[model samples]
Target: MRNKLILSVASLAAAVSLTACGASTTGSTSSAASSAASGEVAVVKVGANPVPHAKVLEYIDENLAKDAGIDLEITEFDDYQTPNIALSEGSIDANYYMHEPFFNDQVKTKGYKFEHGAGVHIEPYAAFSESYKTAEEIPEGATIAITNDPGNQPRALKMLETAGLLQNIEDDSAALTLTDEQNPKKLKFEENQPEILVQVAKDPKVDLAIINGNYILQAGMSTKDAVIVESTEDNPYANFLAWRTGEQTDATKKLDELLHSDEVKKFIEETWPNGDVIPAA
Candidate 1:
């Protein structure tokens, strides 16, 4: 079922109150805005992560898409795999959560016929823990929670490697299959969906949780609370809007244009002043 998105600050506030704070679904599977003149709006159903992806699209839906005669139906997903699956199976017109490398990995592994739009935003990953105040304060045998999705798993591991939590960083971008010797602290890693990275961070039992910046923002928190954050300097993981190969719909096209617009850029810059979510070049 498609849920319609109306134009208002209240709608945006609703999204922030829910997904920004780690609630599972937002606004009940939203439908794309439709054209009244033609008697039916082109519903470009898009799947995205809840925090910034859906919020950005909602901004476009309210401010930009109405003028462009484009309607965006945003479907929210938690994990990395399902959005691509929904896009591939014709459940949605496009998606806006992952970057080039993650998308390429999905295509190569699952052979999903998908292509990307313009670069949207960069949400760096970080290590957040309620167990320890500092990185050194973390006790041995601490339980760590990371995203289980193959696309984001390496990112979590890479962040850990950079924090000196894991040594002998032979391949930071490869599959995470570390031996006992590879991890010095002998920390127990608990794999989870990317959407719950923040949830894990909130768990008192878990020592540490590696969460994405967008979710952290949704949780009414910032990367400043994290022990270690992934560097944004020439970061390769630039999130973008994507659709099926050679099948960019008119609504998707307008959305792509509006996403790179000045208003959206300004919104991102002002919303995340601490460089949690940076607009991609």
Candidate 2:
């Protein structure tokens, strides 16, 4: 009877030991699964103009970020100044708007540490009209409407100068104000807000207007009608992703990846066929 008791107690001890081992293995597995799930997700605030810039990010936020494990949210801005301000104040993670030249001006003047990443798209500054079929049809001494704002006025003048419609204009890194001293077309310049120039371009009275790429696309004008278009191959005004200077290492790298992704490139090609909007690859 004593020997039987001893064997029974031994079997019970072995069963308890097996149960404890099983519990430990499960606990370890559960811990590992939890650790794997703990990967961090950051909310990146971004700012962009409505048409292509904002529209493009909306695509990235929905598609690209899911794979990268990033949460990109955008705050749209109509004016150029506000987006940068939002970025500076930590309201947004990054901004995709102005070209390098304009971005540099904002950083230098505002004394911020903002920096730009990969060239996403180039909304080429182009001239368009509904009144006249083409530049050849527009008469000499025509009343031309141009954007009056400092940042855009220079761009408008540069496009006109590039077309050879206007002459002897020097491209300056400093402030550029168009003078009538060498006005070859005998063009009368009517200055208005950049947004209004689009309406003016379509007006019967307005002969020709230099419009931004966004506005040009918005107005339903074609590159065929674009007397001149900014070429992405050698274009100087390629738009890029902007962020605080120090943050360019990891977070910004993810954004660059998104910009250069096949999805983005494909989207631009299919969305703006006939090269209305060109990718800055």
Model 2 lDDT, residue 280, Cα: 79
With candidate 1 superimposed using the best TM-score fit, by how many Å does residue 43's alpha carbon deviate from the native?
3.7
Q: Ten residues in a row with the worst lDDT in model 1? A: 22-31
Candidate 2 per-residue lDDT, tens place, 200-255, comes to 87777778877878766656666667766755667778788887777543444676
lDDT of each: 0.72, 0.65
Best by TM-score: 1
RMSD of each: 7.5, 20.0
Best lDDT among the predictions, by candidate number: 1
For model 2, the superposed segments whose C-alpha errors exceed 4 Å read 1-38, 173-181, 219-221
List runs of model 1 lying over 4 Å from the truth.
1-42, 170-176, 179-181, 202-204
TM per candidate: 0.78, 0.77
